[model samples]
Each structure stands twice: as structure tokens, then as C-alpha cells.
Target: MESDSHDALDRRLVHALQLAPRAAFSRLAAVLGVSDQTVARRYGRLRGAGAIRVLGLSDPERLGEVRWQLRVRCSPDSAGAVATALARREDTVWVSLNSGGTEIACSTRTPPDRSDHSLLLQHLPRTPSVLGVSAHCVLHTFFGGAQSLAVKSGALSAGQVAELAAAGPRVAEPDGPVPELDAADRRLLAVLAVDGRAPLAELAAACGKSESTVRRRLEELAASGVLYYDLDVDWRIFGLRTHTWLWLNVVPSELAAAGAALAGHPEVAYACATTGPSNLHAVVITRSVRELYAYLTTRVAALPGVQHLETAPTIRIVKGPGPLPLSSPRDI
Candidate 1:
């Protein structure tokens, strides 16, 4: 489907989803002013059309696994082959091709404090299919949640979408006020923070709350911009080979502009303004180091106010609730 049209339907669903993922069709219809069956049919169609996908996401860091974003650059013909090799690993979770180059990126769940780059990158360039590779460690996920929906779609009034998207939503800051969580909410989060696929009813039972109440609370939390949700796909089975994180230090004045530039690049999977002397931070996933360094020095660093750059190679993840599944924490 055309991205814009697809995005319109996604926006409508996302707005409603932010309120309640498993909301009754009648309730959804009431909000949307449509027939109950219409709500069901539209959602079914949306799922069938691949315009949206709903799944539980886990934080590799918190799951007693290692996590890193691996960057790869490959020959045009070798892209598929490289991806195939990568998909065969047991650590991979996500993988994709970037625009304009044989750029590919992947995320993997592994052990904490294990910096086995050579082992991870081993044989990466062996097939002549591999061009280059780079890996960056993930440190402190500032905001990891559902992607903000498109504002161009007509589903939401332009003003509404803008207001929602413009709120400058933030994630858990180490020193920032840690929002209070009621006993039930904390209980539910504890369950989700461990197993993303925990059943809703099970979670409710665990928290000594009604199923509906638990569901509503989950929705409220998501709508409040405190979580992100998505499906759990194991990419390692698909042959995605690497995971890495690169740390960088750029001129502060041009930080925003540089960050925007990096975000515009399809190569970047995630970015954030960190709390530190370094100023800005980002997570880039790609097929190879060759592609990664090229992007940082060539494409991203080229932005205005870029002064210095650094990278903390993630040896392995220690622990934390990395990101919520398909539901975004900010959506709440």
C-alpha cells in the first residue's frame, strides 16, 4: 500500500490503541462513531494488509541477555546472502535494509559484559558478500517505545496529532522524578518487565485486579507515554549476524541538527539526548563496520555543529527494562 494511505489507517488505530489495546469493539465504535462490526472489520483488514502489527517486545538487557545494534554494508547482490547468514544466529531479534546503499542493520540479545566483537564479526566479510561492519553497545535507553504515528494522515485533526506528537515526550531519566507506581501498576509492570508475552488475564490475576481494570490500567500507562509495545520476533533464526552500538560526542550547538540529520538517515534505528558531558547519544544498526564509520563520519557528522565523536562498544547488556512491547510508553 502507499505509505501515506497506510499511515492514515495506522494513525486512527494508534490513537485508539493508545487508549486501549483490547478495548471492546462497541466501545471503540462509540469513540470512532462507527458500527461495532465496522471496528472489527477495519482492524482485521489492517492486520491482514500488513499496515500494522501487534506483538510483545522485551528488553534484552533486562532479560539476562546481551543487546547490541550491528551495522553492515554489503555488495548489492550480497545483501540477501548477508541477511541470510545473520538470520541463522541465535542472538538476533530484528534486521532491515537501509536506503541508498547495501546498508543493513540488526539487533541481537546476548550476555552482559561480553565484548566478543571478533567472534560476532567473524566470517562477516568472508563471502565477498560482506563489505564492512560496525557494532555499538546500547547504554541507557532514554526512550524505547512505540513509534509515533504519522501526522499527515487525515484520521486525526492536524491540530490534535500535532499536539500529541509535539509534547516532547521523554523516557525514564536516571535522576529525573521516578513517577510513582501504585501497587497494582507496579505489579503489572513487574510481570511485563519480565515476560512480554504474559497473558492479560494472568497479569490481572497476579495483581488482584479485574481483567478489565488491568487492561485499562495498561492502556492508561501506555497513553501516558511510559511504555512501548510491539511483537517479539527472533531474528537470529533468520540469519542476521551482528549487534553493536557506537558512542559519539558532537558539538553541542549543532546537537539537535545533527541528531535530526542522523534520524533522517534510514541507517539510524534510535537516537537520544543523553544526560552527560557528551551531550548527545544514538543507537545505529547496520550490516558492517565499513558502513557504520562511513555513516558517522560522512553522513551524520556532516551536520552543522558536529565537533567530536566517540563510541562505547557494547560488550554485553547488564540489566534493565529496555523497551515495552508494541505499546509506546509515551502513548499513555
Candidate 2:
């Protein structure tokens, strides 16, 4: 009973964070009906346990950058090493070992001014153990990043969510002009990428600026839609044991509707339209294989125009949302 209660509280807290990643503890406590100290203690415990993290991530679309999803096939022995090496690169966002540990899936972002295929052409092919590599350019994202699965948890009441949302930071209009990041902005973002809730003083120190300056810059970056916070939590903690990637080929005319529909599904963690054979891609989480089967047969089947579907179950996740601590190796 106590464990269940704890889990419920944790879920509510996580959901609140998803709505407002940097909201003050007092604000969270007010909405959660808990003491300020309780909110702080719970967040600290979760963070220390490696079960949850709040990351401030840059949006490639907002920065006029290109994002690619890479599927690398490797010998079983080399898959782990190669995935680790890829995860260590600052460009790679997340890396996973899939297909019984013979395949690696990762996402990388490149600046718009540079040739996006340089990494794909210059590396991986040279590695003897790599059997194949497929790169898919991400054209549009229907759901992901700041929009997390926690938002679908329904742990908090609608009124509570509205209260928190009202107090949260405002994001700029999507059609606004893209904002460029200077060296100081990059330094500040580097710190936030590791810890989204870092203190203002710490951010200022990292960026070599005053606290007021750092605060203003932070707000400017966020309001510009270039910087946003994301939550990384262990789904296992919530009894969500199955994680799978779904690649679907939808009729080009129905592509937008299909992606929009998938974005609204509770099982979907991320959904996007990409340039490849499979135009629509999504990450799904379920309690078990049986639940996944039901989702596919029912909800997924009901989508507008899914011509083909491919499910790739994740065997292991080498890296999650935030940056890895290791340095990139010269060779795999």
C-alpha cells in the first residue's frame, strides 16, 4: 500500500515537472497539496536514484538544424561498443541497442550550414563490424522533446494542470524568426543540458556572466523557442516494461493526419514524419507485450492510412535524453 502511494505521488510530481520543468518548489507544492519541503525532498531523492532527470535541450528545428535518425547494424560484439561511441558524441541525442542487440538506433543533429551527411559518409562504413547503416532525415515532429508521455499519465487533475501551466514560462510563437546562439549562450546551454534546474548563480558562473544577465538570457532563449526542458524518467518505475519503436508507411496525402493521430495516442512517447521508406515514426511504451499487441490491433489499426508497420523492440538503452559523460573516440 505504501509503495503504491509513493508511486502515485511520484507520478504526480513527474507530471507536474513535465508541465513546468523549472517551476519553483513552492509552486509545485501548492498545486500538489504537499509541503514545499516534501516536493524538494522527493525531487532530490528521485534525481539521486538516477530514476529521473530534467534536461534543457535545444530544438534543432528552431535552430535551423537538421536531425537524423540512424539505424546501424553491427555484429553482436561490436554493437555495444559502437553504440557507446556514438552516445559519447555531443551530436547524438539518444542511443539504443535493439533487435536482440545486433542493431543500434540513435539520433543526431547537425547545423544547417554544414553538410549533414558528413558523419554518415566519413564513419561507420570504415568499421569492419558494421553490417549496414540507414539514415533517415527528420522532416517534422508531431510529438516529442518537451511533450512527454507523463503528460498522458492523468496523475494530476485538469485544474491542477491548468494552474501549473498558467505559471509556467511562455514559449515564443512557432513562426517567429529563428534566434542564433552566441558563444555565451552555448556555454549557458551546455550547463543546462546536464541539469535543467541548475541554480541561476551556477549558470551565470558557467557562462561567465552575472546572475541577472544569465536569467535574462535564459528567458530570452526559452521565449524564442530555441531552448526547452524535457523530462527523462525510468518507465520501469511506473511499471511500463515495454518500449518499442514503430515505423509506419502512410499515404503521403494522409501523412499529416496519421502523424497527428499518433501524437495523441497515450502509448506514444515520440512521433514524427521523416524522409524515408517509412514516413511516420513513433516510440511507444506499454506495460507488457500483451498490451502492445492490443494497442497495435486496436488504436494503431484505426489510424487513417498506415500501409505498413515495423516494430523494433528496444533490447537496451545505451543512453537517454541528456548528454553522456564520456568523450567521443577518434575511432570506433
Worst 10 residues of 1 by lDDT: 232-241
Where does model 1 exceed 4 Å of error?
Answer: 3-10, 61-66, 87-90, 99-101, 113-119, 123-128, 140-144, 150-227, 231-249, 252-269, 273-304, 307-332
lDDT of each: 0.52, 0.86
> What shift in Å separates residue 312 of candidate 1 from its native position after superposition?
22
**What is the overall TM-score of model 1 with all chains considered together?**
0.52
Query: How do the residues 51-168 of candidate 1 rate in per-residue lDDT, one tens digit apiece?
Result: 3444333335333455566667788777655665565554564454543337666666665555565435666756577778766555545433443222112465654444444432
lDDT of 2 by residue, 72-101 (tens): 999988998999888888888768888788
In model 2, which regions exceed 4 Å deviation?
Answer: 1-6, 325-332
| Winning model by TM-score | 2
